[model samples]
Target: MIYLDNAATTRTAPEVVEAMLPYFTEQYGNPSAIYSLGSAGKKAINEARRTIAAAIGAKPEEIYFTAGGTEADNWALKAAAECCAGKGRHIITTKIEHHAVLHACGYLEKNGYEVTYLDVDRDGILDPESLKEAIRPDTVLISVMFANNEIGTIQPIREIGAIARERGILFHTDAVQAFGQVPIDVEEMHIDMLSASAHKLNGPKGTGMLYIRSGLKIRSFIHGGAQEKGVRAGTENVPGIVGFAAAVRRALSRMEEKAGRERELRDYLIRRIEGEIPYCRLNGHREKRLPGNVNISFRFIEGESLLIMLDMRGVCASSGSACTSGSLDPSHVLLAIGLEHEEAHGSLRMTLSEENTQEELDEVVGHLAEIVQRLRDMSPLYEDFMKSRRDRT
Candidate 1:
């Protein structure tokens, strides 16, 4: 099968699985216990923390483990708002963020904190100047995604971070899609809070981390028996943590080579699809997007039908984010970029990984072209447009 949905999640690497086996069996003791086995678990967690921290140029003590990116996002937005409420009750974010951040912002809105949903350009690039103009005296925190999950648009995070830092506002970024795939230095970026998940980078699911910039007065996220130094609670997933570190180390080692290969194929895939498919538009910035992401919209064809047909043809792709795939509504990301509902409904996101071969990409594009053509042939929207053109001619 040709699998091209790495933006949703990646296959767990074999080395990551191997690194987790010992933790799941021999060192399965509770980390809070004083026994040797338990101490081993605790030590492994610390080591994993250090590995993740070093990957982002953050200190180990500031990294707090959580269930995944969703939980981390929820913690970052909610806790930061509460902690900084005395100073202000306002937050700033963008419309193209994953639902984890969007929903968290919504919840904050219902609780009386004001949130500004900043806009992006047609290519899904947010202007730092717009963010700068939106800031007010009451704005306490700024949250922006490191990279767009659906369109693969990389944001101007450094510029945005600098703007927030200059104003003394707490800056948070949801880096779930960019954490291991791209180079990230939290210190250099001036990222006060950041969220990442292991599953996005070929590690086990159910593991993630939040970096809180070595104390800026954020409150406890979860209240229970003092886990995560009382910042978060509940027993740790030792095996998951070990696997996460292994994946990070492996990704770091192969990042340059893997990224170059993926980027080459990504451009190839985009070129083939756009060159072959008619009435198609590429989503996101061509030069500033992720290395292995290709999102396109085929006019007059429904994205769902195209995806289903591609699946039948042994290609696995997605219309949008996995979380919102069930919803019939067009993608929020697409809409934020000024796509009409029909165009948004026609959008398809095909993300790749190091495991994806160029041959597989070739297969996917062939299948996609056929599927889009087949769907458009049966669409009345296509018929009407063609009839109008013929009459005009």
Candidate 2:
């Protein structure tokens, strides 16, 4: 199959698997134990933490390991809310955030916090000026994603972070999709907290990290032992952490090369599809999107139908996020970008990885164009839309 859903999750690299194998069997002792094996596991976790921290320009101690990006996001938003509660109970975020951020914010709203959900531009880019205007004296934190998972539009995080910093408010970004693909320096961006998942970067699943800037008084999400600087509890997922670090090292080593190739291929695919298919438009910014992201909306065809057709043709893509796969509702991100409900339902998001080949992408796009045409032929909505267009003319 030509897999193109890297934004949902990536295949764990062989090197990452090899790095994790020893930890699963040989060094299986808990990191909290005092035995030699435990010490070895502890050492591995520390080294992994240091590696990941250095990648993002953070100190090792400031990086806290979590189950995955969702957990990291939960911890960051909740902790920030609680920590800044005394100052103000208001938080700011974009409406296009991943469900992890949205749901966490919803929970906060139900409790006591007032959250301001900012709207993104037509291309799915958030406005820094809007964020500035939304900031009140009671605003404690601003959570904007680094890159949107559905549309792949990269936000102006540095500008937003600068705004938050100037106002003495904490800034957090959900970097699950942007972590390994882009260069991230927490200090340089003035980010107070950032969340990333390993699986999105060709690492093991169930492993992620939250970067909390030094001296941030945040509360713990999980409670038990003194793990993760006594902030995140439970024994570390030593093997997963080790594999995540290995993947980070590998992805960052060839970051430029891989990103360049993916961007070229993504553009090729987008050009091919738009050229071959009628009533199709690209979603996300033309140049500011993720290197491997290609989200497009077919005017009348259902995204689910197109996804199934692609799968049948040995291509793996997605309608939107895998997290919200079963939901029948149109994508919130698409709607936020001014798409009608029908347009949102007809969107397909294809995200590539370094492993995908240009030849495979070409084949997939060819198949996709044919599939979209086939589905449109069977869709009465397409007929009605064309009829209306002819009538208007």
By lDDT, the best candidate is 2
Model 2 TM-score is 0.98
Q: Kindly list the per-residue Cα lDDT of model 2 for residues 1-393, writing each as its tens digit.
A: 889899999999999999999999899999999999999999999999999999999999889999999999999999999988999999999999999999999999999999999999999999888888899989999999999999999999899889989999999999999998999999989999999999999999999999999889999899887988788889899999999999999989999999999998898888888888888889999999999999999888899998988888888899999999999999999999999999999999999887788799779878977888888889999889889989999
lDDT of 1 by residue, 1-393 (tens): 888899888999999999999987788999989999899999999999999999999999999999999999999999999999999999999999999999999999999999999999999999999998999999999999999999999998888899999999999999999989899999889899999999999999999999999858778888887889888989999999999999999999999898898999999988898788889999999989889988998899889988888888888889989999899999999999999999999999999887888888887877877788788889999999999999999
Query: For each candidate, what TM-score against the reference?
Result: 0.99, 0.98
lDDT of 1: 0.92
Clashing pairs in 1: none
Q: lDDT of candidate 2 vs native?
A: 0.93
Which consecutive 10 residues in model 1 have the weakest lDDT in total?
Answer: 363-372
Give the alpha-carbon lDDT of every model: 0.92, 0.93
The alpha-carbon lDDT assigned to residue 200 of candidate 2 equals 96
Q: Quote model 1's TM-score.
A: 0.99
Superposed model 1: Cα runs more than 4 Å off? none
